[model samples]
Target: MLNKKAGMIAAVALSTSLLVTACSTQTGTESQASSPSETSKPAKQETLRILSGVVGGKTPEENALFEKEVERLTGIKVTIEKPAADYDKKLYAAIAAGEKYDLIYMGKGNMDVLVEQGALTQLNDKIKASKVLSDPKVIPTKEWDMITYNGGKIYSVFNKSEGGTLPTVRQDWMDKLKLQQPKTLDDFYQTLKAFKEKDPDGNGKDDTYGLSTAGLYDIQGFMSAAGVKYKYVMDANGKRSIPYATDAAVPIYEWFAKLYKEGILDPNFATNDSGKMRELFLTNRVGMVTYWDAWVGLFNNMKKTDDPKFVAKAIPGAVGPDGKVMLRRGDPSVWGIPVNAEHVDTAMKFLEFWQSDKGNILSTLGIEGTDYTVKDGKYSLTPDGISHGMDHGAPFPNNTNFKNPIGTLPGALEGRQIIFDNNATIENSTKDWPNAEKIVTNYAFQAMMGKMPAADAVKKMRDELKAVNLID
Candidate 1:
């Protein structure tokens, strides 16, 4: 099995591109046998319908090839339904109208809604009886625990957790400026100042900023550096309190204000999203960013065309005033089966096949030797594999079972290790809290931009939390 964090990165890559091959018209007529013992002999053919989200569109030819391969291996034909738009509404409406599906790919929140409505099946018995699916090795214990609810009834299975973002900087720019990676909060400030004033891009233009960030969430590293927590914290009396409302956040906001006032931070950061931030970095308008470690591949690929010398390096988040680094983890994405599906057994078998070694190879590496080669117990991609296998492997719609043997660049791997080492305090209590994240982002932006005083903003945030009964 791939490391959980690395598996998540590949899963996201696949989810964004989805299965882009064209839809297949060829139908399988063969039926399923009673067990794997009877798999060699032909039985009745069954077609399983799956509902999924549309991330990227695929060509008809590609879809046909994938469908054919799956049918050849599992003796089951599959149909994937992706709504053109309004996916959540359509998904629930279909279930409410009694439409049946073998599998459904959804967020955990949506899965919860379906489970409450009794639209999803309990997979405990089916999973236990499954030959391939019963193996706990395929899915991580933490992820399996996430999907198991209502006293151990399994309603869904999720992709691996993507882990946390780490602070990354332009190594080429740092080399140009003769600067080292920042170690402490003060060092970080000085580095950003140098990035702003020194024109690290070497274009002799005053168009660069020290940092490009979207919202308060992007500054989780800063909060860590300041020895402050944002989501929640334990009070002196042992009661839970919103950390954003406390004095600990004051230093963080003050630093943000300084960055904005000094022009080291992007002026439009109040409105910038991740795409905009990436645009800034890719276009050479910024020197540093905090993002998922997986993006190093994307940045490197894009820079190769524009500026081959451009290099990004990942560093563990800057050490805080208290000499500790903290980061938050991301939630897992999940998939489940419908209660009213016609072929429950067949659906479980498909899942089993998906997690099997052969299935993992097909989905992750495409055809072996053509897309990749294994030597000395290690896998290396061929030139063709680099173009197709990394970006165009078989799409595993609901599950990601393959280890990303190709892996990411060394800097990314190092950054991933740094995050693992430093992410000792995870503020995951707000994972399921509605509007908590948005409230924090809005208020933090206001404070950073000077639209409101930091103290006032904190008070208002506390009031909002009280209204929601999240804090007393």
Candidate 2:
């Protein structure tokens, strides 16, 4: 019985081995016969992970069209991570943990910190090697110099901006009140007074104000009128002194006090931010404001819904009593690659593509027929584009610092040019002083509100600066 059982087991084992061999042979033959070309295709495309603060909180679905377009153009997939809050903290945390991000969008100050910590890679060689970045026409020499570090290493890309804010007024209101555009400080004051005393909006409720200022009340413009240099002013002896301690600042503050006391200035100026000030102008509560030139489009479009007759004009900053009108240059946003980036070459390639002409057109203009149309070299926005194109996740190479003369609104470029031409006398040296803006803003608010006398405020400001060893 045992011998019979052993023979049966041997036969079953042999049968199983033969069946396995037959199945393997058949599978191999089928695979070889079926399409070999499909099996020999290339690997999947590379994906780049970028961390940025300016993702504008777009969800995956909302960003689908942009993502698809970018991928189609660059042959690279992109994943953007935008922190809901505490962006800087989260960004630093990720860097500290050695987590890799192909690209990062950060301010100059933060970039400096990251560079100092060796968290960012120097891109001088990478930028030079790239065909797109090496072109002087694509990336200007001046912009390249701007991004170059003190050690002569290019660590980031600079976003160029048409700097300075323009003081804009309601042209329709000025027409109704029979007032010309204000050019001089006296003219500005009188215009504000008229706007306050007279109903510029014609609501007959005495609800409108002459001027609405948020935060610093735009004292920089006012100080320019007095020929006061920011940060430091030259004394009678030709020695530099803090601006707060200068004689020119006194008149400026006194003027602010007068405006505040006379109700020509918005009473809620202390707490109002840029958004609230914009709301005030759009709601027809204020006749004049100092803001970015781009806001003109926003104001016009918003007001057109209710009052098609509403027109806002960007006017030159008021000339000071000393005949000087200064405008400060604005700093642009920057993009940097981290040292631990898994795909540095891919990241560089993405930036090169972004600066390319095709990329610039796509980012700034969107799909031509769908968003805008060009006739005789003039670009006109489609109705749907005008309504929704402003923030529709379109690529904004210029917005992110890739240089292109696209995406500017009608009259905005001209207005910016006018401001640049007239603001030759503006000084921006005070920007280097740490906490100088905060000191000026605080003292200006106190002096304007009559909470502290202008002279006393200046004395207190100088004293505080001296205490902190910021001033002599």
Candidate 3:
């Protein structure tokens, strides 16, 4: 069949992309010395190759210009390539095949394995010695500590973690329904009830819900508002406990059960994927959904042409009954060099340059002339820039000193402040206790749907986790 043949060809192409000449001369890094006279020899035209799993969007010219900028600023030639699929397997395979990449883009999950195999170059001394790398502004001590393990040995550096979600809601609907923005958990409950009852979408048919998300956990902003922590917690004794199976989570389930009973929460929420959730939000079927801060601009970008009055805005998190507001962020993106990588000094220089102010702006804001332009001290983004999106090596840079000259998506700054102001936490995405997550989701859905009592659901969840030896 034509399809089968095409598949094989595609497979061959993917495999070919991973190939690299293992010889020292072909290591993709080379340095040439300048003329040395009585004055001095300024040496090294360092070239570094990066094998990345994080896919990016840039035309050949666009990327070339960025690469040019990087080299011009840091005196290093950088090249990057990413396969469109099967990244984790291909990355390990390439390393196994002796691919001498100067830098590798990987996730936190890959760190332990790479460290165990002695595949990554140790960064503890490198970080401590370098001016740019050692600065707390370039990377906070907390973030560096996250990557430090095996008796305080740091092997990798992480880009900035994505900010906590400041979920957007239908401001138009809230205005139409004569509802004020919700501040407290109770206020949120009432607002959702009004959205259900008042025909916020203004259609005669009763086809709207107050809020929806891809999964029960996707509505975690509200759960956080109700003072629930979903991730496992560690005690001083080094014992781990999942909060989802504890008393603290009971009220959150009960709250959702109330919403379900009142017909405020969407029935399909349990089954809906992210695409489905966004479709419902865009088409005016749901008034609220948990999403990132960037969705404010993105939702408008996607829906505004059809509906001129479409307005989506991120709001501050609701205060819980415990009188506390909280939000959770995720771990940062990790990158490291292989132990056998050539031009180690050059590679470190490039990375340090990336952590600088200028490099941070270039990565996040796109090119000056094309993605955006400034005139008379006023800056604005081009249409092409919005289309390109913030897809880059460090969309959220770890550098605390870096500021976006082009600004950011709506509510981004405020969202960062909210995280800073509130009792925020970052869930460890790497840790999982086998079937624990599936078990939690199952019991959570049932509890919110009112099929089982909250107490019973927690007990069942604990039992399931126990059966798998995830918890004792």
Candidate 4:
């Protein structure tokens, strides 16, 4: 009850934070000199209110920069309120009350719900008029519209889509074992067998497992590599049906059960979350783990505290069941500005700055000389990299040139290159693989709950999807 009350209070605070305002009079040297005829020139000075989840520690400095640049370009005052963890709860309350906010930064799923409820402003007309929607590289309009509500009434800009797993192994251990990177499914099995039997981590005990994958979302990473996709129910003549009683999902569970029985996989994976998995990796208890390129930064950061020499690298590829290289899923972009504002002109100006060569660099890279500096052709920041984490500093200053900047965060050395290679492998291998969405989603969580056989779960999903006409 206490928790619920706290949540409600937090939600109220978030929704109303920017709604109530104490209006202020505007006085400017330039305003006094304006021609009398210019008095009707749209409201020249207006305030725009925004609600967001971005933590703001260094925000004052960045806010100052934006304020100066925005006012000089368009006469508007922007007041941004960014909440932290309880953001979702607060956002929903505001939506329920029809609270007004000029802009909002939110998640894809919630954005969908809000759009359906008419709580969000549609930017279709504004986007077309602005002409930024025409640039494919800048905004992959069609693909990103999947994130929009019906009729492409875009509510938010897509951020970045990432889906691929780069399984990082302990190279030093592999070298000690005289093993070449496993190229075939059989070879991978043998490598795991050896890692389990031969003591790969070199602590002289049978502690390290050959592979570690959790039962939650991480399981999909492994299954995708094995060429499986899972979705929920399907439609026959537009009627929904279950998918956990299918043939396609059976093999997945069978394989996992085999692994579980073999002792090559960590037994506790049925409940391991990312943080727990990270703990396993950091302690060097697991030989390899499935992760995206972002995990590399975490591993790199770990080097400073534990072992400075504990470097991890992505192998060329991992073999799927068909004796072909495999990769994981893809995520869509998730960032953009809204159009419901008194300061629409000024907001548009800020959007231009964000996408502009100057704005792009600032958004991604950070202030020059402070966040990073250019050397030769590359931009570099230290290992302990500066955190805009809670510090709402302005966008990075040097990252504007690359239309599509890859990697988890900006300024990680060679980070984008690594992501590119991983993405390419996933694209190539999964090109011909079936889009087994039903089997993927249905049986996935079963593994997490230890409820049913992974194979049974997958097969059930396939049958169910097929019954409702999901498979061709």
Q: Model 4, 149: alpha-carbon shift in Å?
A: 5.3
| Candidate 1 to truth, TM | 0.76
Model 2 scores a TM of 0.78
lDDT by residue for model 2 (213-304), tens: 77663545556677655555555675546765555688778887899999899999889978799899988899988776656765776667
For 33-104, candidate 4 gives per-residue lDDT tens digits of 686555432333556676655422235565555444444443456566655446666667765655666666
The TM-score that candidate 4 achieves is 0.68
In candidate 3, what are the lDDT values of residues 355-427, reduced to their tens digit? 8886676667666777777899776778877766654556668888877776665545555666667776655
The model with the greatest lDDT is 3
Taking all chains together, each candidate's TM-score versus the true structure is 0.76, 0.78, 0.80, 0.68
**Model 2 ranges with Cα > 4 A deviation:** 1-41, 55-61, 85-98, 228-247, 320-322, 366-384, 387-408, 423-437
Of 1 and 2, the candidate ranking higher by TM-score: 2
Worst 10 residues of 2 by lDDT: 1-10
Per-model root-mean-square deviation over C-alphas: 7.6, 15.9, 6.8, 7.6
After superposing candidate 3, which stretches have Cα over 4 Å from the reference? 1-45, 53-55, 58-75, 85-100, 107-119, 300-308, 316-318, 368-370, 373-380, 429-431
lDDT of 1 by residue, 131-230 (tens): 5566656664555665677589988655323455666788899998899888877788899889899988888889899987866545778777766665
Whole-model lDDT for model 2 versus the true structure?
Answer: 0.65
User: Which residues of candidate 1, in runs, are more than 4 Å off?
Assistant: 1-43, 54-69, 83-99, 109-119, 134-136, 226-241, 320-322, 362-410, 424-432, 468-470
